[model samples]
Target: MHPKLVEFLAGCRDEAPLQLGVLPFGMICGIASLAAGMPAWLAQLASAIVFSGAAQLVIVQMLAVGSGAAPIGLTAGLLGVRHVLYSVSLADYVRHLPRRWRLLLAYLLTDEAYAIAILRYQAQTAAVHQSVPGTPPGNTAPGATGDAEGSPVRDLRHWYFFGCGLTLWLTWQVSTAIGIVFGATIPADWDIDFAVPLTFIALLTLLIRERANQAAAAVAALGALLLAALPYNLGLVGAIILGLMAGALSTRLARRTRLAREASQ
Candidate 1:
């Protein structure tokens, strides 16, 4: 098999397990769309464009209550503001790709995709860092970014990202269709709501092993509690901003502390 294909397959394989959480989220979006009086076709189309489960859910609820276009647009845009940060962080990894490829990958980039893909991209950077300890970031690390002397991982990373994104995309579409058709028939006793948090908590715990992550998580939690009264789900958006800021600050502080220790030595 081609190495790129292998990387793609590995991404698909790794992402498959996480669909346990994604499937229900998609289904609920479909179900809720139906309950909100959205025609099946439009609901499915909305699913394709919106893509993000939480954002889709908020949009559906807004549509249900007859919210105006402006508020809905503002709310959805705010909800997705975090993706800008995700893209900025990921730009270093994919900057060398052609524009078409970058656009396609950005479309595929979601919270789930970002969570999984960023880890893989960072691992590639770490490999380079280990190979040349003390090399600075940015231009120095473009090797994983397809410089003439780029690492194989950098050259083939898009394949893995494509694999992960494609799998999630397909799974979501299929699950949405199922919900549109049979969502009303699902038993309430099944209590699928628990899976929502359970799945994310698992993802969260896995990512929160570091102090920076823990600090960020704590601040986000506190922000959510304090800001829960905000309208149009602004609380959630505020919490995300708080979390990202906390994480970035903590990461910078840790790096500075490490450099200071090394300088002292």
Candidate 2:
């Protein structure tokens, strides 16, 4: 088989395990959308329109409560702003691609795809650096014009990304469809809704590996508790902003402290 197809299949294969968590997560969203009184067609349409599980839940919750559009817009923007950061972090690896390639890959990008694709790209960088003659151990600054761009591995890497993303997208769509069709028949006592928070809590545990993340999460929880009475779900918005600021501030402080220790030594 061609290398491009190989890479593509590699991405799909790697993303398979993560779909275990995703299946139930998507089902919860579909069931919630229906419970919120959305039409079946509209609820399924939302899986495509607002792809993020968290964002969809927030939007559907607001709609269920009869909130105004202004708050919904703000909340959605905040959720999407994280994607900009994800794209920027991955931009250096994809810089040489045509605009069409970049745009299509950008749509496929997601939290799971990104986590897998980045590690693959980094491993490529390391592999090339080691295999090439006279390359420095630390010289991984391989942009479009660099040594990595000329290699076959570089050519096929994006296909892997596409594969991973497309698989998740397909799984999400199918899971949502199943939930929508059999939602009413499912027993109420199954307590499947508990999976909603459990899934995110598992994800949150993976993310909070440092003081900065801990700080951000703590502030966000406190902010939400304090501002819970705010109308139009503005309290959640404030909590998000405060959490971001706290994380940023903590990161800067940690960097400065490390720099100071190095200077003294």
Candidate 3:
């Protein structure tokens, strides 16, 4: 097999678990969207255009509960606010792309794609950083310690991310259409509600490993519970704000403590 094909296949294998984890959620979103009176094509379009499973789920749920356009749109938009952060992180890798490509990429920037791409990008960056030349004669900062020639190869990683994202995108659209077409035939005994939270727990487990992250997540959970009764799931928005504040404050405090310790030394 060609080297690029091997690399691509490896990436697909590596991301299989995540793909499996997201497919059910995507299918649920399709069912919920169709159940909520959203057009099947609309669900597919949202999945294709927005391409974020969480945001699409929120939009469908809100619509199902009879939310007006403003609140429903706001909820979807807010859930997707994380994309701004994703764009910032992925910018370095995609910066040289054409204007149209950038716009298309921004539209396609889902969480899973961002996660996989960032991991690959970071690895490539570290490799490059370690290969820099012209270190000072006496400097000892692990200067130029990675493979500089490897930076451009990061672009190859984008193909894997794109393949994963596109596959999920197609799955979401098709699953949603099936639900719209046959929702009445499906039994209502399937407890998808339980599954959603379990999915979230798995995703959170993958992302949160540090004490600060744990604290931030705890605070967010507390805030969400406290505001659970708020109308139109505004509680979720509030929880996100509080979580951001908590995380930022925690980081600031950690930085200050480090500064103080350095000063004392």
Candidate 4:
């Protein structure tokens, strides 16, 4: 097998484990959509179009409760605000790719895909940094770029991203289809919708390694609970904004403190 194919397959294999969480969430989104009175076809269509479990659930719930179009749209848009940060962060690595590939990647860019891709990119970057002439071995920092000689890794990066994204897209679609088909059969007492928050919590646990991230998450959770009475689920949007602000401020302060300490030393 070609080396590129091997990388692609490895990417798929690496992403396989995440499906354990994703599949159930996808199915729950589908089931919840139907349970909330969304038509079968439209529910499936939202799965394809929105491809966001959280956003889809919010949409379905709002629609079921007869929410106005503006609120529904606003809620979905607010839920997806994080994607803007993902796109900006990923833009540099994929900037050299063709426009069509960029467009497709943008469409397929999900939380799982971003997590895997960014980790891979950072690893590759660290390797490249370690290889630099003046840099001591094993002393590479984040955000370092590999040399032009590392072109092969760079080339394979896109294929690996494609494999991961495609796997997620297929898994999500199939799982959602299953849910739509058998949703009515699943007992309401089962409360499959719980899987959605469980999946996010799992993802959040993985991401909260830094103190800033931990602080942000704490603030977001508290804010959401306190503001739960907000009309049209606007509390979610508010919580997200507060989380971002807290995270950003804490991160900046940490960076500044580190820099000042270094200067003093």
Tell me the TM-score of each prediction against the true structure: 0.89, 0.76, 0.77, 0.85
Please, what are the lDDT tens digits per residue for candidate 2 over residues 186-232? 78898776765665565567667779989998999899899999865
Model 2 TM-score is 0.76
Q: How many residue pairs clash in all the candidates, one count each?
A: 0, 0, 5, 0
* CA displacement after TM-score superposition, residue 110 of candidate 2 (Å): 2.4
Ranked by TM-score, top first:
1, 4, 3, 2
Most accurate candidate by lDDT:
1
Which has the higher TM-score value, candidate number 1 or candidate number 2? Answer: 1
Candidate 4 residues lying further than 4 Å off, grouped into runs, are 133-154
Expressed as tens digits, the lDDT of each residue in 37-62 for candidate 4 is 88889988889999887788889889
Question: TM-score: which is higher, 2 or 4?
Answer: 4
Query: For each candidate, what is the lDDT?
Result: 0.83, 0.79, 0.66, 0.80
Residue 85 error for model 4, in Å?
A: 0.9
Residue 217 in candidate 3 has what lDDT? 87
What shift in Å separates residue 201 of candidate 3 from its native position after superposition?
Answer: 1.9
Off by over 4 Å in 2: 122-155, 201-239
Higher-TM-score candidate among 1 and 3? 1
For candidate 1, the 10 contiguous residues with the lowest summed lDDT are: 136-145
Q: Of 2 and 3, which scores higher on lDDT?
A: 2
